[model samples]
Target: MKRRKYPKANKMMLVSLGIMTALSLPIQAEEEIFQLDETVVTATRTEQKVKETPASVEVITRKDIETMGAERVVTALKLALNLNLSEASMVGNQVSLRGMNTNQTLILIDGRRMAGEDAGSTANVYELDRVNINNVERIEIVRGPVSSLYGSEALGGVINIIMRKPEKPQSTIGLSTGSKQQNASYHLDLGKQGKWAWTFDTLFTDIQKQRRSETTNMYGPRQFYNISGTYDLAEGKNIDVFYERMSEHLKTTDYTDDGGREYFTNTRNSYGLTYRGRTTRGNYELRTYYNELEKNTDQLEGPGSYSDFDRANYKTWAIDGKNTMRLQDDHVLTFGGEYRTSEYRGTRLEDNGDAVSTVTEHGISKSISEKSVDYQAVYVQDEWKLSDKLLLIPSLRYDDSNRFEDSLSPKLGMTYHFADNFRLKTNFGKGFKAPSISELYMKMTRRPIPTRTVIVIGNPDLKPEKSTSYDISLEGEKGAAFGKLTYFDNDVTDLIGTETTRAGSVSTSKYVNIDKARIKGVELEAGRHLSNNFTVKTAYTFLDAKNAKTGEFLQDRAKNRYSVQLHYDDAQRTGISSILWYEWVRDYRYKDDEDKDTDYNYGTLNFTINKKWNERYSTYFGVDNILDKKIDELVLEGRLWRVGMNYTF
Candidate 1:
């Protein structure tokens, strides 16, 4: 007799099928189930239940974050449908949603923009790793373009991190450690006392670096702290202020130097003040904020060449206000305006020991070599309840900038209750992403090989990237069962790419709007409850991404992806609990450092068990990548273990 070993993908499929079958068995649910009463504010700037939103939205609660052992926002979103995540190397750890590129995604904290690499790219991406989950109350994810509300980088989607604000007095402390990682966190909430309240939170994390022959880049320790306070002026009127800061150490081992390493620290600091009040028929908010990002090097122990620039800094300041009014029982209107300024500063050493940076705003002939830009935007939206079962929303926005042509974004959204416990939702919109300072006015010189020299230049005349987006879905919720099916399509133009012109051994590359593309996908998610203690959910996505002009498939776009989760807990919400999660990805292609095509598929399984000793103490333990899966040593980490304990008072 011979024994057969089943592949990991097959094992995942089997587990999924078994769970589906088990959910089909005849059994009565013991208590209330499904997400029916949850309210979200991102979709329309109005408080509405998840089932009433005009777009597809997913919410991750605080319980989900602790149960899954997710350290950061990126880890919690890894298994979500329609999101493409790269889990391999330090430089490639990014997530793209709806087949759109990484640069088009927007991340917000309490409705304010976060830091972007400080100076990482010419793109609009925030380092999701810097956001610790300790203070997060919930995360709201809205799929598809939301330019009508957020403007610019809202082309792909929006992710909003909502911090915890206590409804009652509370204090919590947590400690956790892993095979190569460790964390400590504290949170304190002072419930409203006579008209004043405040909150404080802090987190620290340290992890061992991942190195293969002392070449690949790595991640290091990080720290975060946040504080906020509110003062009440009267009934329905208040003033709020907040401050936050974070720092992360980034490292890369030097292969040329025997005992050398290169590293830099990314630091972010932000603060804001806001005023809110409600009248008899409307509510309004006015806010002002400032954010700064910088990169610092460690010149004492290693070389001072972690980035192209010796030092880099980016800063942003904004004043924003909005008001929503209820005119009639069936009519609602919302409008707002904002003014913002963004500046970038950098200096680099030349081959001759002199600093280089020329401030020119004209063309690629000279590096933008220059400074900053300012923007002003205004937007309006109208919502109409035409009938008992139909809702229509129309919105428009105009953006004016000092550097480029003005842009107008318009969107239309519809929701119809076609059947009991089910609704049909659709959204059509136009979105855009402004060219970054590094993209519009950049100039760089590089020597790739002994015989070749390359110079890269930026174009100041470049237009912003644009996209036409559409999505339709049917969502339903019933007794212990919930499901959704969605179809998304995005056609993009004025895509920014590089073009090379070679003369002899010297090559000149310039940025231009030289390409067009199309990204379309189908997403399906379904879940059911077996009883009060057990619940199961599964999601699948199929993506087709391509370049319109070349008709070639996009790099790193997986054709199929799947995830399944099984959860067990106490009916009273206090006792032992467990979560078993599995995810599989298939048919994806990527170009490695050497520019060689690497095609592969992989799966991972994770488990966590938690116990509550009493009202004040709890503990959890978990294992990730239980099968010890590995791919080319550049992807997922092998098996890892973690344990943690928490106390509340």
Candidate 2:
């Protein structure tokens, strides 16, 4: 690995340390103290406090989201430690966790999986934009392999979003405007005990295009809508349904002398239903869902003398069921099964003056082409309490797919209390990811001109990527302070890579299984609540990732990252509250077009102040990137000011 000199990085670290010291100095005078014991459910199928969970889990509460003034789910996720964001053309932004690529992370809503692939083999991070932040109760992140619970796509970790359940009648309306965007949202909850319950939520957002010298955005307007409902059938039985829709339209101006234009449009729809009940044995849930996505692009050049069009569509349907049982006082069991099917279709057309042709890969051209795949899986897990201070959990899963071979994954975890307020935890798990639809059957062509041609083909014989992960941690608490230190290692086999072959003048690229890769990292998180109204929190992460076969460092992974935040609530002592946050991301390396390492780094500061005028209304004002720190190519918008008001009835 190569190192680059960054003078600012050291300064940023010192700044954070200085702030912590300053805050601690004033704590000795304060007598009141408070501790946090946040509840989380993603680590296991059942709910438990973050401190009790065997795995390292992070929880982002609704109050945290509101204090940060985050308008979208992606914005809130960016604040998490060790998570990196990357930009992908046409497919929006992607996220990498624990030095693993985007595809290795699995995202879920209410314990159900989301679609894992896009039209061009890109990961589906953009789909997160559809989730209404105002309706979310909380988000739980488990940062390690959980394939024993989830089937595939859990090599990196899992993010589960839990929606709020309406218990009483209430309503809220909010509107916010910023330097680059505008948003409005409405939420209504109406219900009566033992009868029926319903919840309605909707949000609308608009973003303006931005352009700078040598750096411009081709993206355009976007909109999202979500609706959900629930009904109670009996004393312990209920049904829930939800629907979401998203769309975007974009146009880009040509930078060349030809003065060409490119138009692109993308739309997605998702809906699902779930039936839940509590029986004498335990609790059970059954769910079914469907999702569809469509993308289209049109290009015009040289005063309409040349034209081209491309279109792609993807759809998926799934059914899942799970049951939890209590066999004894100290033993609990959970089992689940799932069935899913997915389909993909794409078409391309080219027109040049006297001739019109359809572009294709491997001389197989058609107006429209289609492919489909199906999967079935079952899993079981058990939690055993060996004694008052020791606990053990074991999980296993089996999956069978029409497009690939069968797979089996297993995991074991243990937790032991070493002292009054300290515990030791360890986990070992196996994970796997099946080849995506686009990677297995996609047929696309690039640069269809006669002067130069490049074709991309999909290999149906590609094997599934697999991994083994191990981690151990020590966590404890004293008085009003809590801290945790963790170390983890993940080794992956049968890695997927793209191979290009050229015959004569035609070049072809296809997906294949490669050798081995490994990632090792250490994390430290500490926080202290000096008083009931004042608190401080910080985290640091160090990662080392490489390809074991080639001995080359992985691309686009930061070796060191850290975050610090200071918060004050006042507990309505003065009817005013404020929060100050500072974050610094260490320099990371990436391979440019010429395969040379390039370094990128930056830091940001944000502050928000809130005032509750009365019981009916409250207002907040905030400034993001107060120092105006930015990397033009990486950041979409910089140094923004926003104000918003919320009305409750």
Candidate 3:
């Protein structure tokens, strides 16, 4: 084994932190309250312990995110039960869950959908640089069908990003430097007793230049800010407002076969505003968002000039209102309604000349845009206590959209407690998804003008896709030991995507209400405290995806994934704490027409050490990719290694 030395770049982080400390004078001090055992509000829409949630849910605490050396949102999710990550483009990253498409999984920021991206793909949790991690309280992940609670995109599940609110007056500053790039961040929290509370966080990072396939110097810079606050009006009544702005400069280099190289650059800006109010009668929320994605390409060394440039923009506004009432000793009822309007615009212009000498401008010949969706949905759910140890939950929802016909979904679930420390829950549900504008109506050109064909055609009569899902879970806890096991299966129909055509090149295959697809999987999680000084946590997942009609396995589904973590903390040793983690994942083989079986297995090990000098100050060091293993998370793409540190005050 080799003892890896700290890179000189690490000193840059220390120097930056020293300057931040010297600039701020020691002012007022506040009590630092440590919150372990987080209470989740997303799994059931009510406060419950992670161990008590009947569904398969993973709750990542802010402490866990910080200690794991994870800066982005999706990095924390990598070790989750069954999630797959892929890069769609410079600005687009896709995440699929339980062998479902990316669009089937819903992403929620404080219980609201992020401004929707172009239909087929979306930025996952990590791509949302808008929300600062310093402003996050905790993340709640509900795995399996949640369309009963959240409409539409929740067919796979829901990931809710809960932002941090000021519990007390506090402020913290942090700086970190890592391979290829580095970032600096700050957070300010203010709380006034019985009146108001708010938080503000900002971050800036410079990305390092890297050569992908091509030998071009390219890197992406990210900057973002978050502002959120709450106002108390009366008992059980409050108002919450949140806003976020994110900007990033993304660059990608591609090697060409004709002794030339190509470089792509994209500028993305996203902004969102949401307001919510709750009263004794009910709750209401209103949100509006705008996202602009523009791209500019420059070939550093090529015969052709900067050509085939484009931009895509999405704008959305939505309103959601709900009410909950306790009708009887055994019955609780909830009802909600939501409306959303979204618009997508695509524009492009091509250059036909040299670098300095501008010759032909193709004008904006490819300005095809559509404002196709204004969706509405109404939902209701009821929880009935059949007995002291038995409960039943039933829900129904209806969605109406202009491009697609109406849909009705129903869900039934039950949770039974046979013992004080053990419980069993089973849920059966139906879900649906409407075609995106891109899928229904888009014209793209690939070859040189005059001869390119419209590869994709819209079917004005496209129908909404649907799925039926079932999940069974068991949870138990005794003293310091906790464990959970879940099994899930989903059958999908009328999934829309492109398939190989007779022409050899891919063409848009019309939506076919065809064969049934099935995804069956199991998840196990366990955690225990070995002693007062040591704790261990681990999880494993096994998945099988197949076509119910053909009896053949689905493509690109990982067979096995597992993770283990150990933590040790000692107050006697200068308040020192340490954590060691290892993760393993089996590669997913594509089941193409040839029936090939190619596989790859990879693992990662990481460690972190932290010391609290006193109550008000703390510093931490972390090393990731401990083995320096060059594992390609996405084969054909470059490998990744991340490490950093932080000091909080």
C-alpha lDDT score of every prediction, in listed order: 0.77, 0.76, 0.64
Which one wins on lDDT?
A: 1
TM-score of each: 0.90, 0.90, 0.82
Candidate 2 local lDDT, 243-344, one digit each (tens)? 877777876655553566677788888899999999887899999999888877676665664456676677889999989898898888999999999876
For residue 21, model 1's alpha carbon misses the true position, in angstroms, by 9.3
Answer with 2 or 3, whichever has the higher TM-score.
Answer: 2
Per-residue lDDT over 527-639 for candidate 3, one digit per residue giving the tens place of the 0 to 100 score: 66566778777766778887787877665566666767788877453477778877665645443336654554556687776666766666666666677765232332433
Local error of candidate 3 at 457, Å? 3.6
- The count of backbone overlaps in candidate 3 is 0
The number of clashing residue pairs in each candidate reads: 0, 0, 0
Q: Candidate 1 regions off by >4 Å?
A: 1-36, 118-126, 212-216, 255-260, 297-309, 348-370, 446-454, 502-507, 571-573
Please give the TM-score that candidate 2 achieves against the real structure.
0.90
Tens digit of lDDT per residue, candidate 1, span 1-649?
1222336756666666566545444456434464447888887877777877787788888777777666667656755668766754546455577888877888788888764542224343346666768888888888899888888888889888888875678999999888646889999888888888998999999866655443645557889999888899899999999999998886666554444555678899999999999999889999999988886543322353322323557788999999999999888899999999887765321221224455322122222223677989999988889988999989999998998988899999999999988999999999998887666766666553448787766678989889999999988766777778899999999988888899999988788999899999888787787677888888878788889999877876777778888888884446878889887777676766665655567778989888888888888888888999876434666787888988999
Off by over 4 Å in 3: 1-37, 86-93, 121-130, 193-196, 210-218, 256-304, 348-364, 447-454, 500-515, 570-577, 590-597, 631-649
If ranked by TM-score, best first, what sequence of candidates would result?
A: 2, 1, 3
Model 2 lDDT, full chain set: 0.76
